[model samples]
Target: MSALARTAARLLLGSAMVGAGVLHLTTQRQEFRAQVPEWFPVDEDLTVLSSGVAEIALGAAFVALPGRKRLIGGLLAAFFVVIFPGNVAQYLESTDAFGLDSDRKRLVRLFFQPLLVLWALYGGGWLRRHPTG
Candidate 1:
Protein backbone atom coordinates (compact mmCIF):
# COMPACT_ATOMS: atom_id res chain seq x y z
CA MET A 1 0.00 0.00 0.00
CA SER A 2 1.10 3.52 -0.68
CA ALA A 3 2.11 5.09 2.61
CA LEU A 4 0.53 8.37 1.73
CA ALA A 5 -2.80 6.89 0.79
CA ARG A 6 -2.82 4.66 3.83
CA THR A 7 -1.89 7.57 6.02
CA ALA A 8 -4.55 9.81 4.53
CA ALA A 9 -7.28 7.24 4.85
CA ARG A 10 -6.18 6.33 8.35
CA LEU A 11 -6.18 9.96 9.43
CA LEU A 12 -9.58 10.54 7.94
CA LEU A 13 -11.04 7.43 9.50
CA GLY A 14 -9.30 8.01 12.80
CA SER A 15 -10.52 11.55 13.12
CA ALA A 16 -14.07 10.39 12.59
CA MET A 17 -13.90 7.76 15.33
CA VAL A 18 -11.95 9.97 17.69
CA GLY A 19 -14.50 12.69 17.30
CA ALA A 20 -17.36 10.28 17.81
CA GLY A 21 -15.76 8.67 20.85
CA VAL A 22 -15.23 12.03 22.42
CA LEU A 23 -18.81 12.97 21.72
CA HIS A 24 -20.12 9.75 23.18
CA LEU A 25 -17.72 9.79 26.08
CA THR A 26 -18.53 13.30 27.23
CA THR A 27 -21.23 15.48 25.80
CA GLN A 28 -23.60 12.93 24.33
CA ARG A 29 -23.95 10.56 27.26
CA GLN A 30 -27.66 11.04 27.88
CA GLU A 31 -28.44 11.26 24.22
CA PHE A 32 -26.52 8.11 23.37
CA ARG A 33 -27.89 6.25 26.34
CA ALA A 34 -31.43 7.17 25.39
CA GLN A 35 -30.81 5.98 21.87
CA VAL A 36 -29.92 2.49 23.02
CA PRO A 37 -32.64 0.13 21.96
CA GLU A 38 -34.87 -1.41 24.60
CA TRP A 39 -33.69 -4.86 23.54
CA PHE A 40 -30.11 -4.24 24.58
CA PRO A 41 -29.36 -5.26 28.14
CA VAL A 42 -26.25 -3.23 28.88
CA ASP A 43 -26.36 -0.19 31.12
CA GLU A 44 -26.29 3.17 29.36
CA ASP A 45 -23.17 4.55 30.98
CA LEU A 46 -21.05 1.44 30.44
CA THR A 47 -22.31 1.04 26.93
CA VAL A 48 -21.57 4.61 26.00
CA LEU A 49 -18.26 4.67 27.80
CA SER A 50 -17.05 1.37 26.38
CA SER A 51 -18.18 2.20 22.88
CA GLY A 52 -16.46 5.59 22.98
CA VAL A 53 -13.27 4.06 24.29
CA ALA A 54 -13.34 1.41 21.59
CA GLU A 55 -13.85 3.94 18.85
CA ILE A 56 -10.91 6.02 19.99
CA ALA A 57 -8.68 2.99 20.27
CA LEU A 58 -9.65 1.48 16.94
CA GLY A 59 -9.58 4.82 15.17
CA ALA A 60 -6.21 5.83 16.57
CA ALA A 61 -4.72 2.40 16.01
CA PHE A 62 -5.82 2.34 12.40
CA VAL A 63 -3.63 5.38 11.80
CA ALA A 64 -0.75 4.50 14.07
CA LEU A 65 -0.22 0.94 12.89
CA PRO A 66 -0.42 0.47 9.14
CA GLY A 67 1.24 -2.91 9.30
CA ARG A 68 -1.61 -3.97 11.51
CA LYS A 69 -4.24 -2.30 9.39
CA ARG A 70 -5.94 -5.56 8.56
CA LEU A 71 -6.44 -6.44 12.19
CA ILE A 72 -7.57 -2.99 13.19
CA GLY A 73 -9.87 -2.67 10.21
CA GLY A 74 -11.48 -6.01 10.95
CA LEU A 75 -11.98 -5.00 14.56
CA LEU A 76 -13.47 -1.72 13.50
CA ALA A 77 -15.80 -3.44 11.07
CA ALA A 78 -17.06 -5.60 13.89
CA PHE A 79 -17.61 -2.48 15.93
CA PHE A 80 -19.58 -0.96 13.09
CA VAL A 81 -21.84 -3.97 13.12
CA VAL A 82 -22.18 -3.74 16.86
CA ILE A 83 -23.26 -0.13 16.63
CA PHE A 84 -25.63 -0.67 13.75
CA PRO A 85 -28.56 -0.69 16.13
CA GLY A 86 -27.77 2.73 17.40
CA ASN A 87 -28.00 4.02 13.87
CA VAL A 88 -31.27 2.21 13.36
CA ALA A 89 -32.60 3.59 16.61
CA GLN A 90 -31.70 7.06 15.47
CA TYR A 91 -33.49 6.56 12.20
CA LEU A 92 -36.53 5.05 13.84
CA GLU A 93 -36.79 7.81 16.43
CA SER A 94 -35.74 10.76 14.29
CA THR A 95 -34.21 12.29 17.36
CA ASP A 96 -30.81 13.50 18.51
CA ALA A 97 -30.96 11.70 21.80
CA PHE A 98 -27.15 12.04 21.83
CA GLY A 99 -26.12 13.93 18.77
CA LEU A 100 -25.76 17.62 18.06
CA ASP A 101 -27.76 17.77 14.82
CA SER A 102 -30.97 16.79 13.09
CA ASP A 103 -32.58 13.44 12.26
CA ARG A 104 -31.78 13.96 8.60
CA LYS A 105 -28.10 14.08 9.50
CA ARG A 106 -28.45 10.92 11.57
CA LEU A 107 -29.98 9.14 8.61
CA VAL A 108 -27.02 10.22 6.56
CA ARG A 109 -24.77 8.71 9.19
CA LEU A 110 -26.53 5.38 8.80
CA PHE A 111 -25.36 5.24 5.22
CA PHE A 112 -21.83 6.21 6.14
CA GLN A 113 -21.42 3.26 8.51
CA PRO A 114 -21.50 0.79 5.64
CA LEU A 115 -18.77 2.68 3.89
CA LEU A 116 -16.72 2.37 7.01
CA VAL A 117 -17.24 -1.37 6.87
CA LEU A 118 -16.05 -1.44 3.31
CA TRP A 119 -13.12 0.77 4.18
CA ALA A 120 -12.23 -1.54 7.00
CA LEU A 121 -12.43 -4.50 4.66
CA TYR A 122 -10.13 -2.77 2.24
CA GLY A 123 -7.78 -1.50 4.90
CA GLY A 124 -7.52 -4.93 6.42
CA GLY A 125 -6.28 -6.37 3.11
CA TRP A 126 -9.45 -8.37 2.49
CA LEU A 127 -9.89 -6.41 -0.73
CA ARG A 128 -6.27 -6.97 -1.69
CA ARG A 129 -6.70 -10.69 -1.24
CA HIS A 130 -9.79 -10.80 -3.44
CA PRO A 131 -8.02 -8.90 -6.22
CA THR A 132 -10.74 -6.79 -7.88
CA GLY A 133 -8.37 -3.92 -8.58
Candidate 2:
Protein backbone atom coordinates (compact mmCIF):
# COMPACT_ATOMS: atom_id res chain seq x y z
CA MET A 1 0.00 0.00 0.00
CA SER A 2 1.03 3.57 -0.49
CA ALA A 3 2.37 5.47 2.50
CA LEU A 4 -0.50 7.89 2.35
CA ALA A 5 -3.11 5.15 2.54
CA ARG A 6 -1.30 3.39 5.33
CA THR A 7 -1.06 6.60 7.30
CA ALA A 8 -4.73 7.26 6.77
CA ALA A 9 -5.68 3.83 7.99
CA ARG A 10 -3.54 4.24 11.06
CA LEU A 11 -5.08 7.59 11.81
CA LEU A 12 -8.54 6.19 11.47
CA LEU A 13 -7.81 3.33 13.78
CA GLY A 14 -6.19 5.68 16.24
CA SER A 15 -9.19 7.93 16.23
CA ALA A 16 -11.49 5.02 16.87
CA MET A 17 -9.37 3.81 19.77
CA VAL A 18 -9.38 7.24 21.33
CA GLY A 19 -13.12 7.57 20.98
CA ALA A 20 -13.81 4.12 22.35
CA GLY A 21 -11.39 4.66 25.17
CA VAL A 22 -13.11 7.82 26.20
CA LEU A 23 -16.44 6.08 26.06
CA HIS A 24 -15.14 3.32 28.25
CA LEU A 25 -14.17 5.88 30.85
CA THR A 26 -17.30 7.94 30.56
CA THR A 27 -20.73 7.42 29.05
CA GLN A 28 -20.24 3.77 28.14
CA ARG A 29 -18.66 2.61 31.36
CA GLN A 30 -21.63 0.56 32.42
CA GLU A 31 -21.99 -0.93 28.98
CA PHE A 32 -18.34 -1.89 28.89
CA ARG A 33 -18.69 -3.38 32.35
CA ALA A 34 -21.30 -5.68 30.92
CA GLN A 35 -18.78 -7.05 28.46
CA VAL A 36 -16.37 -8.21 31.12
CA PRO A 37 -16.23 -11.96 31.54
CA GLU A 38 -17.85 -13.17 34.74
CA TRP A 39 -15.23 -15.72 35.73
CA PHE A 40 -12.30 -13.29 35.51
CA PRO A 41 -12.56 -12.36 39.22
CA VAL A 42 -11.73 -8.71 38.61
CA ASP A 43 -14.02 -5.85 39.44
CA GLU A 44 -15.90 -4.86 36.34
CA ASP A 45 -15.42 -1.17 36.87
CA LEU A 46 -11.70 -1.54 37.36
CA THR A 47 -11.36 -3.67 34.30
CA VAL A 48 -13.22 -1.16 32.20
CA LEU A 49 -11.16 1.72 33.49
CA SER A 50 -7.85 -0.03 32.97
CA SER A 51 -8.75 -1.14 29.49
CA GLY A 52 -9.86 2.38 28.71
CA VAL A 53 -6.49 3.72 29.76
CA ALA A 54 -4.71 1.14 27.66
CA GLU A 55 -6.79 2.02 24.66
CA ILE A 56 -5.97 5.68 25.00
CA ALA A 57 -2.27 4.92 25.25
CA LEU A 58 -2.37 2.58 22.30
CA GLY A 59 -4.36 5.04 20.25
CA ALA A 60 -1.95 7.82 21.01
CA ALA A 61 0.96 5.62 20.07
CA PHE A 62 -0.60 4.79 16.73
CA VAL A 63 -1.09 8.44 15.91
CA ALA A 64 2.16 9.78 17.34
CA LEU A 65 4.73 7.16 16.40
CA PRO A 66 4.62 6.69 12.68
CA GLY A 67 8.24 5.65 12.56
CA ARG A 68 7.57 2.83 15.04
CA LYS A 69 4.33 1.74 13.47
CA ARG A 70 5.40 -1.85 13.02
CA LEU A 71 5.89 -2.27 16.74
CA ILE A 72 2.81 -0.28 17.64
CA GLY A 73 0.71 -2.28 15.24
CA GLY A 74 1.94 -5.54 16.64
CA LEU A 75 1.04 -4.39 20.14
CA LEU A 76 -2.37 -3.18 19.05
CA ALA A 77 -3.04 -6.46 17.30
CA ALA A 78 -2.04 -8.29 20.44
CA PHE A 79 -4.41 -6.09 22.41
CA PHE A 80 -7.24 -7.11 20.12
CA VAL A 81 -6.27 -10.74 20.53
CA VAL A 82 -6.17 -10.36 24.27
CA ILE A 83 -9.64 -8.89 24.50
CA PHE A 84 -11.23 -11.44 22.17
CA PRO A 85 -12.36 -13.63 25.01
CA GLY A 86 -14.50 -10.82 26.32
CA ASN A 87 -16.19 -10.83 22.95
CA VAL A 88 -16.68 -14.57 23.29
CA ALA A 89 -18.00 -14.16 26.79
CA GLN A 90 -20.43 -11.58 25.55
CA TYR A 91 -21.70 -13.98 22.93
CA LEU A 92 -21.83 -17.04 25.18
CA GLU A 93 -23.49 -15.16 28.02
CA SER A 94 -25.85 -13.40 25.70
CA THR A 95 -24.64 -10.10 27.03
CA ASP A 96 -25.46 -7.20 24.75
CA ALA A 97 -23.31 -4.21 24.13
CA PHE A 98 -22.85 -2.02 21.12
CA GLY A 99 -26.24 -3.31 19.98
CA LEU A 100 -25.11 -6.86 19.49
CA ASP A 101 -28.32 -8.19 20.91
CA SER A 102 -28.85 -11.49 19.15
CA ASP A 103 -26.92 -14.70 18.87
CA ARG A 104 -26.41 -14.08 15.18
CA LYS A 105 -25.13 -10.59 15.77
CA ARG A 106 -22.67 -11.71 18.40
CA LEU A 107 -21.55 -14.62 16.28
CA VAL A 108 -21.00 -12.34 13.34
CA ARG A 109 -19.02 -10.02 15.54
CA LEU A 110 -16.63 -12.84 16.36
CA PHE A 111 -15.49 -12.86 12.77
CA PHE A 112 -14.58 -9.20 12.90
CA GLN A 113 -11.85 -9.77 15.47
CA PRO A 114 -9.55 -11.25 12.90
CA LEU A 115 -10.28 -8.38 10.60
CA LEU A 116 -9.19 -5.99 13.33
CA VAL A 117 -5.97 -7.91 13.69
CA LEU A 118 -5.41 -7.71 9.96
CA TRP A 119 -6.23 -4.04 9.91
CA ALA A 120 -3.69 -3.34 12.59
CA LEU A 121 -1.07 -5.26 10.68
CA TYR A 122 -1.84 -3.67 7.36
CA GLY A 123 -2.10 -0.16 8.75
CA GLY A 124 1.23 -0.58 10.46
CA GLY A 125 2.71 -1.78 7.19
CA TRP A 126 3.66 -5.06 8.75
CA LEU A 127 2.17 -7.31 6.12
CA ARG A 128 3.94 -6.37 2.87
CA ARG A 129 6.28 -3.47 3.38
CA HIS A 130 9.23 -5.33 4.80
CA PRO A 131 11.16 -8.12 3.12
CA THR A 132 12.88 -10.90 4.97
CA GLY A 133 15.75 -13.00 3.64
Candidate 3:
Protein backbone atom coordinates (compact mmCIF):
# COMPACT_ATOMS: atom_id res chain seq x y z
CA MET A 1 0.00 0.00 0.00
CA SER A 2 1.07 3.57 -0.58
CA ALA A 3 1.77 5.85 2.35
CA LEU A 4 -1.52 7.60 1.89
CA ALA A 5 -3.45 4.33 1.75
CA ARG A 6 -1.80 2.94 4.85
CA THR A 7 -2.38 6.16 6.73
CA ALA A 8 -5.98 6.17 5.67
CA ALA A 9 -6.46 2.60 6.77
CA ARG A 10 -4.85 3.32 10.11
CA LEU A 11 -7.01 6.33 10.69
CA LEU A 12 -10.16 4.47 9.72
CA LEU A 13 -9.37 1.59 12.02
CA GLY A 14 -8.48 3.97 14.81
CA SER A 15 -11.73 5.83 14.43
CA ALA A 16 -13.67 2.57 14.44
CA MET A 17 -11.94 1.39 17.58
CA VAL A 18 -12.77 4.66 19.32
CA GLY A 19 -16.39 4.40 18.33
CA ALA A 20 -16.67 0.82 19.49
CA GLY A 21 -14.91 1.66 22.73
CA VAL A 22 -17.37 4.44 23.40
CA LEU A 23 -20.22 2.08 22.79
CA HIS A 24 -18.71 -0.47 25.14
CA LEU A 25 -18.49 2.15 27.90
CA THR A 26 -21.93 3.52 27.33
CA THR A 27 -25.01 2.29 25.49
CA GLN A 28 -23.65 -1.13 24.62
CA ARG A 29 -22.28 -2.03 28.03
CA GLN A 30 -24.87 -4.71 28.60
CA GLU A 31 -24.39 -6.07 25.13
CA PHE A 32 -20.66 -6.37 25.66
CA ARG A 33 -21.17 -7.91 29.09
CA ALA A 34 -23.38 -10.49 27.56
CA GLN A 35 -20.53 -11.62 25.31
CA VAL A 36 -18.22 -12.40 28.21
CA PRO A 37 -17.73 -16.11 28.65
CA GLU A 38 -19.56 -17.61 31.62
CA TRP A 39 -16.57 -19.75 32.55
CA PHE A 40 -14.18 -16.81 32.59
CA PRO A 41 -13.18 -15.81 36.12
CA VAL A 42 -13.54 -12.04 35.82
CA ASP A 43 -16.75 -10.30 36.71
CA GLU A 44 -18.70 -9.42 33.57
CA ASP A 45 -19.12 -5.75 34.31
CA LEU A 46 -15.46 -5.34 35.16
CA THR A 47 -14.43 -7.16 32.03
CA VAL A 48 -16.61 -4.97 29.90
CA LEU A 49 -15.45 -1.74 31.49
CA SER A 50 -11.80 -2.64 31.43
CA SER A 51 -11.91 -3.78 27.84
CA GLY A 52 -13.72 -0.61 26.93
CA VAL A 53 -10.98 1.45 28.45
CA ALA A 54 -8.38 -0.64 26.72
CA GLU A 55 -10.05 -0.20 23.37
CA ILE A 56 -10.23 3.54 23.85
CA ALA A 57 -6.59 3.84 24.87
CA LEU A 58 -5.36 1.58 22.11
CA GLY A 59 -7.50 3.28 19.53
CA ALA A 60 -6.38 6.74 20.49
CA ALA A 61 -2.77 5.69 20.57
CA PHE A 62 -3.03 4.05 17.17
CA VAL A 63 -4.30 7.31 15.71
CA ALA A 64 -2.24 9.86 17.62
CA LEU A 65 1.06 8.00 17.94
CA PRO A 66 2.22 7.01 14.49
CA GLY A 67 5.72 6.64 15.87
CA ARG A 68 4.41 3.82 17.99
CA LYS A 69 2.19 2.25 15.35
CA ARG A 70 4.04 -1.05 15.32
CA LEU A 71 3.74 -1.48 19.06
CA ILE A 72 0.17 -0.30 19.17
CA GLY A 73 -0.80 -2.42 16.21
CA GLY A 74 0.68 -5.49 17.82
CA LEU A 75 -1.18 -4.64 21.01
CA LEU A 76 -4.39 -4.15 19.06
CA ALA A 77 -3.88 -7.47 17.32
CA ALA A 78 -3.31 -9.13 20.68
CA PHE A 79 -6.44 -7.51 21.99
CA PHE A 80 -8.44 -8.97 19.16
CA VAL A 81 -6.90 -12.38 19.79
CA VAL A 82 -7.68 -12.15 23.49
CA ILE A 83 -11.31 -11.43 22.77
CA PHE A 84 -11.73 -14.18 20.17
CA PRO A 85 -12.82 -16.68 22.74
CA GLY A 86 -15.65 -14.48 23.87
CA ASN A 87 -16.88 -14.48 20.31
CA VAL A 88 -16.45 -18.22 20.20
CA ALA A 89 -18.32 -18.60 23.47
CA GLN A 90 -21.07 -16.46 22.13
CA TYR A 91 -21.37 -18.85 19.22
CA LEU A 92 -20.92 -22.09 21.11
CA GLU A 93 -23.29 -21.18 23.92
CA SER A 94 -25.74 -19.50 21.60
CA THR A 95 -25.53 -16.22 23.46
CA ASP A 96 -27.08 -13.37 21.56
CA ALA A 97 -25.58 -9.90 21.44
CA PHE A 98 -24.67 -7.27 18.85
CA GLY A 99 -27.34 -8.53 16.50
CA LEU A 100 -25.57 -11.85 16.22
CA ASP A 101 -28.65 -13.68 17.34
CA SER A 102 -28.01 -16.89 15.46
CA ASP A 103 -25.33 -19.53 15.29
CA ARG A 104 -24.61 -18.65 11.67
CA LYS A 105 -24.26 -14.98 12.42
CA ARG A 106 -21.95 -15.59 15.36
CA LEU A 107 -19.92 -18.10 13.45
CA VAL A 108 -19.52 -15.75 10.56
CA ARG A 109 -18.41 -13.00 12.90
CA LEU A 110 -15.59 -15.19 14.11
CA PHE A 111 -14.02 -15.16 10.67
CA PHE A 112 -13.54 -11.42 10.81
CA GLN A 113 -11.19 -11.58 13.81
CA PRO A 114 -8.20 -12.69 11.77
CA LEU A 115 -8.89 -9.98 9.24
CA LEU A 116 -8.76 -7.45 12.04
CA VAL A 117 -5.40 -8.79 13.11
CA LEU A 118 -4.09 -8.50 9.58
CA TRP A 119 -5.55 -5.03 9.20
CA ALA A 120 -3.74 -3.88 12.31
CA LEU A 121 -0.50 -5.44 11.15
CA TYR A 122 -0.80 -3.82 7.75
CA GLY A 123 -1.72 -0.46 9.17
CA GLY A 124 1.29 -0.67 11.46
CA GLY A 125 3.56 -1.44 8.52
CA TRP A 126 4.39 -4.86 9.86
CA LEU A 127 3.45 -6.40 6.54
CA ARG A 128 6.31 -4.54 4.89
CA ARG A 129 9.96 -5.36 5.49
CA HIS A 130 10.89 -1.68 5.26
CA PRO A 131 7.68 0.24 5.09
CA THR A 132 7.66 3.28 2.82
CA GLY A 133 3.98 3.68 3.65
lDDT by residue for model 3 over 10-125, one digit each (tens)?
A: 88898899999999999999999999999999999999999999999999999999999999989999999999999999999999998999999999999999999999988887
lDDT of each: 0.79, 0.93, 0.92
lDDT of 1: 0.79
Q: What 10-residue stretch in candidate 1 is worst by lDDT? A: 122-131
lDDT of 1 by residue, 8-99 (tens): 77678877888988988888777778777766789878988998899888888887888888888889889989889877877786656545
Candidate 3: stretches off by over 4 Å:
129-133
Best by lDDT: 2
Evaluate residue 72 in candidate 3 and report its C-alpha lDDT on the 0 to 100 scale: 92
Arrange candidates, best lDDT first: 2, 3, 1
TM-score of each: 0.78, 0.94, 0.95
Give per-residue lDDT, candidate 1, residue 40: 73
Clash count of each predicted structure: 3, 0, 0
Report the lDDT tens digits of candidate 2 across residue range 3-116.
889899999998899899999999999999999999978999999999999999998899999988999999999999999999999999999888999999999999999999
Q: Which stretches of candidate 1 lie over 4 Å from their true place?
A: 1-3, 98-107, 129-133
The ten-residue window of minimal lDDT in model 3 covers 124-133
Q: Best TM-score goes to which candidate?
A: 3
**Rank list by TM-score:** 3, 2, 1
